[model samples]
Target: MRYPSKSALLFIAAGALSTGASAHMGTDLHSHGSFMTGLLHPLGGLDHLLAMLAVGVWSAVSARRAGPALLWGPLAFANMLVLGALLGLRGMGGAVVEPMVAASVLALGLLVLTRQGMNAAASMVLVGGFAVFHGLAHGAELAATGDAVAPVAGMFVTTIALHLSGVALGWSLRAANVWATRATGAAVATSGLALLMQLA
Candidate 1:
């Protein structure tokens, strides 16, 4: 039987630690500590990192207008994500935020495997929605610690970097195997399912 690699298990362990750290920080948003905490928040979580990377990979895999889609899709998602985080911080919603996030991973993976490129406006809408969810997830943690601006900016930069990493990873793999793209999609979808299970 195939098992998750050692690195994968380590990733899971790290994510749990980060989540605990965020929760325990307890609504503090101005300490210099929050900056580093916020910066690592996205990278620490497997769900967040994979989903963000998948956005880029999927964008690149599309047969149509791959360039802008790869760049813009994640950007739109990130912008809206920040907005969602603001809402969460304000206590505007229930704490059951993980479901929505898991759904995004599953949806984005399927979308990449299935959808052809749409017109520019529709494309923006698609990417923007995902970005909002991603941002909100990250943003929700912000209410717990450090200087909001620094941590947020750090996360934003990290988010962009991760997307770019995904794009690069996808592009590199694309050259070697025709199936590489779909494999990434599958990996993403599987990861989402795992996250959902953990959340449950």
Candidate 2:
């Protein structure tokens, strides 16, 4: 089965993005300091949701060259996220981090859009780099929310779930036709662009 055309994909993306693409969590999850808070924080923002899913989408599409892309990409993101949390605990990041996090959506969406012949090493770096910003955000929140490892673990688990969803979405599209990946990529990238505009 064939998916929608490129134009259709872009149109869909534009519509989605135009409908308020910025990602921000208004709820004060940090004040609670619980594992549930970690699980829910990622879902609070459009940017986090899209970026994490794009990572999984790219990895799933990229696994044809090497299986490492599937595991390594997510691993890099998750570990770096923990590291970012440490930095947050120390109050290392500030306003500068927000734009970086917003930009990550654009970058990952681009990767998904161009999901052909990507270097596994480069992909890891890209995914890991973007993850740092996201991690910092997570860390910044968790640090304020609570001083417990459970929250971190909960956050990690939620991230894994999001990645898996992206992987599933990518593979399902791949099963239909390879071109669908590009469509998916375009959609994700367009969403990122919308988020960037919101930030601006």
Candidate 3:
């Protein structure tokens, strides 16, 4: 009997991971009660984690041909994440935040999968648009607590670190195997789709 191809195995892994895409925790900031909680928030959820990493991967992959300028995608995401969180603290951008967050995961995954490219402005708008929802989710939850500065700061720093990690992974994958990068994208996209389904 023949073993599954790498792509098949990758997709299987993606399916396994997506099976539990609850998207976000429903707990309040007071429950966790620390900046570290906010810092760890993104990593706590599959939806946020994949989308954040996808931004870095897409940025680095695009930058391979577009020059270092394409790295701005991740920066755009990080900046907008803070903006979104602040807006969320104000109780804005709440109604559709979850759907939008899941959509970001799907969209960013496709970008990496297809190796899509766009001008700097368009890229920033796209990534930043999605980041707002991620931030909004965080902000909305934390809004009830009345202490957002420290948590948001933690999230901001963590977001940058996650993006940098993704960029490194993207570059390494690009050098070793383009198929692997696309496969990773495919996995991310699958997770996003699963997230959307769960939200629905």
TM-score of each: 0.75, 0.85, 0.86
lDDT of 3 by residue, 12-91 (tens): 37435855746764454346436886787677677787788788878877774646675688899999999999899897
Candidate order by lDDT, decreasing, is 3, 2, 1
TM-score of candidate 3 against the unseen true structure: 0.86
Question: Candidate 2: where is the Cα deviation over 4 Å?
Answer: 4-21, 65-68
lDDT per residue as tens, model 1, 26-84: 33433444556666767655667767777776666553544555677767767776676
Ranking by TM-score: 3, 2, 1
Q: TM-score: which candidate is best? A: 3
Which candidate leads in lDDT? 3
User: Considering summed lDDT, which 10 consecutive residues are worst modelled in model 2?
Assistant: 6-15
Alpha-carbon error at 42 in model 2, in Å? 1.2
What residue pairs are clashing in model 3?
none
Q: Which regions of candidate 1 deviate over 4 angstroms?
A: 1-33, 63-66
Q: Write the number of the candidate with greater lDDT, choosing between 2 and 3.
A: 3
